[model samples]
Target: MGFDARFLELHAAMPRVSEADAATSVELDYVHFSVVLDTARRLARVTGVNVDGASLVELDRGGDDWQLDERIPADWQAGPAVYARNDLDRGHLVRRRDPVWGSPEVAARANAETFRYPNAAPQASGFNQSKELWLGLEDHVLAHASVNGMRLSVFTAPILAAGDPAYRGIRVPLRYWKIAAWNSGGELAAAGFVVDQAPLVDTSEARTPLPGEVPDLGPFRTFQVPVADVAALTKLEMPELVEADRLPKTIAAAGWRRLETSADLLL
Candidate 1:
């Protein structure tokens, strides 16, 4: 009953992505899987930030609800230190709820750097609470790892996605993940986490670490595809803009891409 043997037996894909590239370009240093932020963005946009006025912190922190751990990489210690006094939570792009999640203490380390004000934004409680749904996404894919199999990243970051009325234009990428299934067909999701940019700031400076926080490689994106789909996860859009925004070019320029951006060719 362990995960698909292919996930363990298959050679690790090319390291096509790096933690930095995602924040800036499509380039990366490692490639265990592929990604697609456009889809998640579309979902977020449609779902909107309708948390009923609750806070992200109040949402269930998995409370040991997930099956995996958020491994804390040595990379986090080398980056800008975050200020704990700030209200930001160390958010993970991949959810701990995932049955295949790895590491626990490290998982905790992979939190959204909300401690820093530069990365504050409004998010729907449902988005934060949808842990089960996200995990469901991961479960399906990992169970059948194949030629096009992929794994979600555990990187974490600050956000500025829409839901927030404060940081109205900031979007924070994350490493949190939850697997998703779109059909009985062969297609799989390319991304798990969404580009949540809460409405908040106006600083020209990208999110920098505070007095006590360091750069964490925790916040990252995820992807799911067939055993053979090698194309990139193209930018998808909300149903409202699906036809008009096929590639979701705006999102790509803003910091979100889709699985179609590249195929499962994580090399």
Candidate 2:
């Protein structure tokens, strides 16, 4: 739907963000995916639309030339720029050019929000490219309109640096991801999943885990969340709502409530 009310109800805790700003629009199940992230990590993004049904659309933004913009929580902070050193390109979830979304500015923001190093997986440039199989799945899921309430899932585990506190719990160098979304009761609903399977990549451990104890995230599961929700969760931290947390929320307090998927049909 153009306006997502289900998203609003699910992510009421997060500040509203523009479809133009970087963010997700819905949550989905991971087990249903051919692959999944086994780690006990979480990624709650706010869902938005960018069409790529015809083909993969790579963003025009790239390193050095690309600007870094973010809305961080005042009390929380990062130790340093993690992805600064590496052949890893800033990968994005929301493509900047999709027919559903007209202007490049809005898609730029959505792609930007997912640009965080935490949201990235250590991939060969070929693997991360939009034309690749993995990225193709992402576009398919994003463009899907399930006939039933069933939807796909999309979630990710941060690829951490070796010896860093965040990697201590990780048994595998590969990260995790899940995605799912569809329509219900005249509104669109979404869910996300996590499982101990299908590691997307294998690289040297880049970070240390907390207390040096590997975390068991249990079995694959699901949760409903808004499309605009993006919490600064690492491999260790759990996600929660902050009354006034900074984010794209820094832009303004606007969110979709009972958002309409097909405004023209509804009208």
Candidate 3:
């Protein structure tokens, strides 16, 4: 699908992005995203999504139905088989609610687009409470949207590292990252966060746990870090977004701020 030019206006401006290695771009109706699948790893190099808050709707969550994007070969994307017997959840890269705003029909189409496997990554299903907090990061920003013109764009994807553990022919990423971009007083602004599920995923080839072992492997942690760090890790062109980070300029001099609640966010 061709990317919508208007979607570009909804996000923080950026430098011309160099093509990622063996990347595949899939642009949805209201949500513009790109999928760079690592066929060997059976996962995405990065799935970048741009969402417009003004077009969002308050619809009830859709049925958790997942499908593969027919535009791409079925084998190129991970299927339910990889997640079936594991604790890994098919987590959405582009949040389920972000694009579901707009007219009823438009909202429905965008909602369905979010279910494609290209937009999902394997995440620790055990981080329930922490996941809720991570999901609400945009809500916290949306709260201030009314005053800031209701414009918001978020970029998210798993940190696909080469050494990630392989399972069922797919390598499960240990961490995931998100950057919320918006306009505050006509100035571009953004905040970066990382969710580490390392403690929760057992990447070892042998999946069996010892008898009588506890199943849960949390509590996961989320931290607010510098946008430059996210750009460095994902190797995407985020110069403008990095400059838009809401953290103090001296943040890198310090360290990533650990977040326990939405209240800890800078907005």
Candidate 4:
């Protein structure tokens, strides 16, 4: 009931935190995914989920409850306190519906497991508008995989840069990264993306907020980047994914490509 490294025809193992932070990191397994929490930072360093598009279950998100995993100390996670009375939304790193597949019982469990605090990250509420394009990337990729066995493996996490703004005892990440993997005619194919909300986030106010003031956030800028760039930005090991990247070297050399719609995707 956890992230399966062998889910894809070509193995795409979960990303690892750096050696310096490894000791303090806690790996937690959920229904169909796993989260590696950076205890010191009180946030997830990386998460992975296996997606089966053809067998997806459409579960209603009526309850929408969030809870701390008892397996880890509550302080190890960014709980409700970090998001209360603020514009920050608890964004799911693994994406709630991505792992909701298989039998009814199993699918329901996967849905509830997504609400765990370890799977969430702080994101601007208004960032949703721009996030539409970002989220659509997942749908587009899934649709592409549907024709080729409808399976995918996804890895995601906040950049967790050292310069992130500290607020409510936790640092708010300004950037997030996602990578999607699928089998393309017997070979592994991958696409990587990085989403930035730094322009929307007023870190100065966050660094020194008045008693009730929170960081101000606006829109998000999404970019389709090279897998190597994602590894460099997050300091994670992903040689296999980097080698499997579908982005052309010419396009990657030019720089991160901005995406206004799914049509802009090179994949």
Candidate 5:
């Protein structure tokens, strides 16, 4: 129920805390995480999910029942109405496939946990070139994991910025981030990425709220940024995880790579 020991085994070790406001720690069936309930926003500033790749079975595409976490006050998290008629998608921070690799019974439970409203975030409604790349990064890593014994540990959350556009009582985060770690030949290695949905998101305060409509702002951009930079932007203390980055310390000197496909990923 806590951060799974299996997660630590895959991360090589636990990284530092990412959010100072994490007021609640909730352990799901297969994942362990903490959330900062933004009472004002009716959402989370940070909802960190730790997943163990070894426990993953196959991608479960079955129907999901999205529910509010009874473990916490329902008002503390977003509900389905916020997404109604809004051009936003209820994105799963812990990719549904990541936690499905266990026994049929165990995997079924984990798959269901992935749908809780607390585990969901508001994302730009539709996919674009950048969104596709961002969504596929995990699959690419998993493919490479075959050589590393198919193991991984991932951390993900929306970049909850004060400047995000407010709509229907919730602020729409313009960006999201992910940090994936794995062990290779007895050493810890990790990669950090950020996906910007800014182009498709309208921040104008005067815009009318349309629940089911998302503007086509154009193709989004995905970047392979420095782990240190991710830590700074998200306010997550990830010193050890940053130290394990495969990218050059001078990520700027080399320039962050614009990811177009899995082949473009550094890891």
Candidate 6:
């Protein structure tokens, strides 16, 4: 099975891709998550996963191997080739541990499914302040959700901006976004965030590396943004999530709030 739209008490539909790009996009369902791959960009347009904090399972990832999904052509995915001989990391859009819940066998399958290339995005290898904060967001949200029903629905994807610098026939995204949805008491609650590595990514032609050259990328800058802003930026239709946004309207009017730590989160 894949991500359940009704995983939470309230339903959260998967983000939709635009009609123009729909033809080239392939939706693939994994053990506990789903990815809508933008073949044209050789990356995922959106990925959704269901996390059950109460049932989470811990398993060692000692010998897992990254592989392409056999259902889709290798060319349609930004596989090992893009990350080969570079500082770019094959980042997981749906963090591996999020979906690795349920039974031991099921958790193992979920863990393996995460290694498929469609769920991977190219991110800077170096860790910095913002990147470290970005990586811890899900855990913080999960803990918050535990007070309610211990279930969460998370959506994530690269911005896929046209201006992103080109590398190995694919454009490297400078920004990525995440939306976490859960039930707060009897109401649906959600928060949106954007993390940028623009300064680290030198887009200048002279600095943009030739094939096989490692492109220089800088530290990440994280922000708590409006869900509506995320919808506008990625051209995804997610009215419900926007309406359920837990970020204060006052902060939304003030614009994106730079987040130095989880304490900066309004949710």
Question: TM-score winner among the candidates?
Answer: 6
Across 34-91, the per-residue lDDT of candidate 4 in tens digits comes to: 9999999898889999998889999998677999999989999999999998778899
User: Against the correct fold, how does model 5 do in TM-score?
Assistant: 0.83
Better candidate by TM-score, 2 or 6: 6
Off-target runs (Cα >4 Å) in candidate 3 are 1-40, 48-55, 144-147, 200-218
Error of model 1, residue 231, in angstroms: 9.7
Candidate 1, residue 84: Cα displacement in angstroms equals 0.6
Higher-ranked by TM-score: 2 or 5: 5
> By TM-score, is 1 or 3 better?
3
Question: Better model by lDDT, 2 or 5?
Answer: 5
lDDT of 6: 0.88
Per-residue alpha-carbon lDDT of candidate 1 for residues 1-267, written as tens digits (9 for 90 to 100): 111213323221221222433442221111122122222221111111001011112223444222111232322221122323444443333332332223444223322221212112222233332333332434434444331323422222223134322221223333222212221123322323433222234446446544344322232233332211111221222221121121234443444333322232121
Q: For residue 138, what is the lDDT in candidate 4?
A: 72
Local distance difference test, candidate 5? 0.68
Q: Where is model 2 more than 4 Å wrong at Cα?
A: 1-59, 62-70, 73-80, 87-89, 93-100, 108-131, 142-173, 184-267
Give the per-residue lDDT digits (tens) of candidate 5, residues 1-267. 433535545444444444454444333333454444455566554444455555666754777678888876777678888887756788887777766655787677767777888778888666777788787777777775432666676677777788776666677777888888877777778888988877654547445446634433335689998888888887767777788887776654686778887787777
Candidate 2 local lDDT, 1-267, one digit each (tens): 232323322332212323432232223211111111212322223323323333323575455233322333311212123234534334443323322232456445544444432333333233322224334443444444432322222233333324222422222323323233333343434332222222233436423335633322222112222323423222222233322222234332443122112220111
Off by over 4 Å in 5: 5-20, 23-40, 44-55, 145-147, 200-218
**Whole-model Cα lDDT per candidate?**
0.26, 0.30, 0.69, 0.87, 0.68, 0.88
Q: Candidate 1 vs. truth: CA RMSD? A: 14.1
Model 4 spans with C-alpha error above 4 angstroms:
127-129, 145-147, 200-208
After best superposition, candidate 4 residue 2: deviation in angstroms?
0.6
Query: Which portions of model 6 miss their true places by more than 4 Å?
Result: 145-147, 200-206
Q: Count the backbone clashes (under 3 Å) in each candidate.
A: 94, 61, 3, 0, 9, 2
lDDT for residue 69 in candidate 1, whole number 0-100: 15
Among all candidates shown, the one with the greatest lDDT: 6
| Model 3 lDDT at residue 187 | 71
- Model 2 residue 5 lDDT score: 22
